[model samples]
Target chain A: MTTSPIADALRLPAGPVDLTAIETDAKPGFDGKKADGKGALFAMGDELADLQERLWAQRTVGSERRVLLVLQGMDTSGKGGVLRHTIGLVDPQGVRITSFKAPTDEERAHDFLWRIDKGLPPAGYIGVFDRSHYEDVLIARVHDLAEPAEIHRRYGAINDFEARLADSGVAIIKCMLHVGADEQKSRLAARLDNPDKHWKYNPGDLDERASWPAYREAYEIALERTNTDVAPWYVVPADKKWFRNLAVAQLLLDTLRELDPQWPVADFDVEAEKKRLAEESPVQ
Target chain B: MTTSPIADALRLPAGPVDLTAIETDAKPGFDGKKADGKGALFAMGDELADLQERLWAQRTVGSERRVLLVLQGMDTSGKGGVLRHTIGLVDPQGVRITSFKAPTDEERAHDFLWRIDKGLPPAGYIGVFDRSHYEDVLIARVHDLAEPAEIHRRYGAINDFEARLADSGVAIIKCMLHVGADEQKSRLAARLDNPDKHWKYNPGDLDERASWPAYREAYEIALERTNTDVAPWYVVPADKKWFRNLAVAQLLLDTLRELDPQWPVADFDVEAEKKRLAEESPVQ
Candidate 1:
């Protein structure tokens, strides 16, 4: 309902989308310096932490508002980085994070949303999907993993699913980190070049990267079809890691500020209860 | 396996057991002071944290060692406290916690372990189950929720399941926080007498307490049948909250130390990687 400059600039276009037309190097937020951006992120991170605490406490005495942050991106676009930074700012008890991977045989037997439903945050908690149901269209489409008719049905399924969640008081935030082919290549190469980072660089990623043009087309259509007012998508320019982090953080901070949850009032008589506790013997 | 003095003292006896015979105030590893117990717990907590870090990092490179810490106890027995204190010492990214509550309609339709198997910690993670399969014997038996024959069948099934996990490289540490009726009454009353603690105090807990004798008998039987060389049960004297936390932390720290996972050796050519990385454009 309210606008922030970063949100306005980064939200996907209303009409048809062309991935090639967007600049992947833009920084809509802080002046372009890693130190300044990092500094600003942590500072905003503290505010996010305080708001998160209030959100958690409010739920303890029965407030119903919750948040679901869905992250989608190509390999090396830093979905893990966003989760580590953003969730690191909140209490682990108050946040539920599920990093969806290749579906299991059991998961495949059911509808795509079965596991997603299980991972939804209980009231007043922040739920994050590191990669989400959007993958059905992204990779599944790129690899011909599903029928074209099925993939088409899934886009509508996702919209209806998100609409149902919104009706039940979930505030949805979805982001796609827009990294360039060259940027992803350099990141993967950096992983190869650092022994400590080796585990993170999967050889399979290069296989996925080989199909970048097809994946990009799938993403364009997916975004155009699924970007609803209820759960719109934001395309974050991620060639600069710091700017990407900043934009995502700003989006969360603004969205949470609008929710403005408060701690619940105590329901019992404070004085009488304190006296009763004093009368009970201490631990033996 | 090497033994810690605390483990030797607290590990459940091999045969039939009486809950009443055990002292609820023993601090086997600590001097008789809250400060001393708290200090020693934290000292061991740091050691656990370091070992957990190595185990997590090692798995990223490739190590099969993983830990499953299953905590079983009645209400107000400090399972949540143990989770908060012990797991608070480890990286959240490396620990997978599943706090099992009552089974849902879907969960009840399958075998009891169906959901438990789904939640088993992946390789390289420490999995903590707040309540576990043992509940089938404990609550199900006491409340007449299942047939005696079904409960009898479940014990062998549980042992088989644990053996499978052991064969797959999972180290199991199961503990029962042995709090006396007096201690539970005091804790429940403490909740009732504090306005801030009211949410934790369910009035139905009193109804459960009315069946205390039956529950105790059920727990004694459950512990007897499930305690094995592969996955032994430790009955913690949990009337003293500090001692309970210290004993659980000491168990985890000692178990992890024995596993002794280390950072994996890198598999790539370091010198060549450094040279090739120098040729790529630096992150701008």
Candidate 2:
């Protein structure tokens, strides 16, 4: 469902995904100044909305195709920004957003992917994962939450899980929002400065921030190991949030456009129905 | 989902859907001749399409509400007509239609409701069944497809099945499209006369048509036994196909309006998202 647009440059090449080689403030596609970019973003939003409505309409009559946008980013890497700015353009009813948090007691009891299976968008939906199954490999690897042997096992499991979803009409678009350490610090400082944002500025985010190098190393390994043909990975630069939002929007719009779902053919006899309606209806 | 509009007159009273007592030609809610009724039908269509899109949108954002429209009638009772005219008014993407045929080996392997379970629409969807579980009682009784004892057991099973569906945010609207024998005979003759409609004119339909009285008795027994508060049956007079379409559309529209789902609140920190976007986004 993905097209080889310029946005594909944002994707990590197969094998090892070198974090240092990828720019955290890249703006390859957007040529305009911020004002023009924002205008373009709004225009993209309208197109995304129309495309999403068409997707919903196609699915309503029984198309089984779907799209999933998997977003993985560190604290203040603009995952939420992309959500609010890009995915938010589409109607919420056609969008399924799952913000994976600390596992609940019931979720903890099941396998890591169990909750993911439950959260998948049904056929003909656009699903956004704020933080997803990638957490199992990323956080778990950085913190040594699982055994080394088990972590490697999960990589294969993740690939298989994504493949199964893809086989069942899910077009997976995985994104890693790349941010420089300096950019992260500035965003964190801004959060602390704003009193209203105190609610969002979780103290634990600082704890995770402390493990930054480990987390980035973990992400490189994840992107390399789980970067798939069925579920391709895109590395969006997060230092410039506008660029990040635009790239993500363009990426999604490109995929949806490629899907190009149509209105379903009428399942009933159209001519007979028209004739019946004409005969029965007393319209002049 | 059955509203107490003037259309309520079309519904068989709670006791029994007495096929004999009910007049098939009655157009209770439709006041005008064919012309006015057609105008009203188009108005209802516009309203239905809008409401259905809203429903699809609401469900996309994680609502578990849905509607299951179970349609049944003797052959040529305008089930296909309703699909083309009324349900067609709604976008195909939001509607899931199931035309249940004779149970497959896999379906028959499980209990009767297994196929139904596989076909129930997900939340935020409108599911239409051209012929549904009612056939378990109606056809199985008249044609001796299942045992008399098993036929009685199925009624209880069906009640339990619909109750489970209703409890899980599905609004069930079952309609028995009632057509008088003479009306059916004329419609069948017209189908024979029209070469274009030959695709719809099944030779097996004539075989079923021959056992009309037996099917009527079986339907009478089935309707009386299974009508519950959770999934009530609305016996729509189908001799006037226009009235049938309008009544069904009105019923579905009224149900969706009653559900009246609102757009979901943002799950993210809105003000914080706005702030971050303002700071990081170079846009004025």
- For every candidate, the chain B TM-score is 0.96, 0.92
Q: Cα-based RMSD of the predictions, in order?
A: 5.3, 9.7
The sequence of per-residue lDDT tens digits that candidate 2 reaches over residues B80-195 is 77876787566555667777888999988898899999888878789888899899998888899898999999999999989988899998888999998878767766755654
lDDT string, candidate 1, B1-284, tens digits: 78788888888879998887888777765555889888888787567766876787778766778999999888999997787666656666677888788889999999988999998988888999989998988899988778999999999999999999999889999999988877888887787765546666665666677777888899888889989999999999998998998888888887898898875665656566545545544332
The TM-score obtained by model 1 is 0.75
Give the true-contact fraction for every prediction, in order: 0.10, 0.00
Question: Which parts of model 2 are misplaced by more than 4 Å?
Answer: A1-284, B1-4, B275-284
TM-score of chain A of 2: 0.93
* Ten residues in sequence with the least summed lDDT for candidate 2 chain A: A275-284
- Please report the candidate that would top lDDT against the real structure: 1
Clashing pairs in 1: none
